[model samples]
Structure formats: C-alpha cells, structure tokens
Target: MGPITVTDDLARIDLDVVHRWLSTDAYWALGRSRETVEAAARGSLSFGALVRSDDGDELVGYARVVTDRATFAWLCDVYVAPSARGRGVGSALVRAVLEALEPMGLSRVMLATHDAHALYRRHGFGEPAHPEWLMALQPTPAASPATPAV
Candidate 1:
C-alpha cells in the first residue's frame, strides 16, 4: 500500500479515471455517461484513494455516500481500479468514508454488496436486524440508468 492516501476532497478526485472505471470495468454503473457520473459525484460525499508515483498521485479507488448528513447514509459506488488492487485500496477507501462520516451524527450507514461481504463485515457492517423491513424502489433494468454489477 506504499504511498497510498485517502481523502474526502471532491476536488482531489480524478473524474476521468473514476468515469472510466465505472463505465467500463466496474460491474455497477456500466455504460454510465460521464455527465451522469459527475452529477452524482456532486451530490454525494466523495472519497478517493490515490497512489503516489513519479507521475504524481493517481486516483485508484473511490467511494461515495449519499446522505442528508443528518440521519442516514447510503454508501455506494465503491470501486478500486484493477491496477491498484491487492494493495488494500478498497479497505482504505471504505475506512476513510466511515471516518469522514463519524462526526455527522448519523444514525445509520448502509451499503449493498454481492460478494464483498467479508470486506464490509470487518468494518462493522452486518446483516440488518430488520431485514424484512428493508425495501427498495428500484426501477426495472431497462428503466434504470445505473445498475449494480459486482
């Protein structure tokens, strides 16, 4: 994880890299337009992980929280670039987001994951006690502009 840094500064995020990952590599948000992504970024609390190299710091991981910053937060769009994986980038990004939210007085933070349950589990996220009450207004696949992949 050498020289990797996590920050909540939206200005520090590299939109091109983030848009590329979400639009192509990431299972979620595939084929999402750059404009849509930029809009989403502006509406969310953004976190980015960067790896410092001779070329300077490159954005390698990202996560965002959609919240009113009062009572609830939904963590989404967590992704790490392929070249930056296996170096704890994902962990760093998640932890950073959590830390940033610590002072917001939020009562709950939620996220949905298909296969990375273990990663989130280590961060204190667990199965909801009232799973039966959880519901979504998810649009049909064709109707939705964004979809969750892996």
Candidate 2:
C-alpha cells in the first residue's frame, strides 16, 4: 500500500506486471494479448495506474483510455491485480485516468465493460438512454488477434 499515480506513457510502463493483472479471472475479461495491450497503452492519449507496492511496486492495477485529445475517447482494459482487489485500486485508477484528460476538453469519454459498471458509475460514467440508437458490432478473433507474434 504505497501510492497510486496515473500515467500516459506506457513505453515507461512495466507491462509484464500489468499483464499479470489482466490474466486473472476476476470481474471481467478483455482477452487481450501482450502486444495489443502494449500497443493500446502506447497509442493511447492517456493511460492510468494505481501502484500499491512502490518499493516492490508491481503494477498492481491499471486502466487505459484511448483518445484523440478532443471530442471522443474510449476507456479500455481496466484491471487490478487479483491480490490487490477489494481495495480502492480500481476506483483510483479510473479516477486518475479520467482526471488527467479533463483539460483536453473532451465532449465525452465512452467505454464498454462486461462488468464493473458500478466502478464506472462512481466516476461519473453513465449508460446511454438510447441504447438502441448505439448499436454495436462485436469483433472476431480474426478481426482482433490477441497480439502480433514475435
């Protein structure tokens, strides 16, 4: 239990630890691969973190938001390490990410979650009333391969 901080640059991130959190069978799963996660983080306008173990600081939790720093953004791959669950890591991660981008003057930030709606709600995320108006198309494994092969 050290401190939680949000960051945008993932080339500076320790992805292996973040990957461990994603591998856990908790809350929801994105089924993302190492390369994709790395790519997403690297490409994102903002990425966030909640480091609970500073001295031994493994990347206990994380959240990522991809945006053009303007009117649209998508939040994705939010996770907390299994061992670090039940604490406020997820909440803090979400908060940190969201706060970081407020200055960009985004019209809205949208996200899709299989679970954890409450967490999002706590941070001012809401469901669209016209769910029917916002039809979605799921991607296939072929369409979204986990990661590029080394």
Model 2, 6-114: lDDT tens per residue? 6666754688766656755533444657786567667775354646453654566677777787666677777776777777878887777767776776666677766
By lDDT, who's the top model here? 1
Residue pairs clashing in model 2 are none
Name model 1 segments beyond 4 Å from true: 128-150
Q: What is the clash count for each candidate, in the order shown?
A: 2, 0
Q: Which window of 10 residues has the lowest lDDT sum in candidate 2? A: 132-141
Question: For residue 7, what is the lDDT in candidate 2?
Answer: 66
Cα lDDT for residue 48, candidate 1: 90
**Tens-digit lDDT track for model 1 on 1-150?**
467799889899998889999999777789999998899999998899998877888898999889998877888999988887778898998888878887786666778766566677666665433553221222222342233211
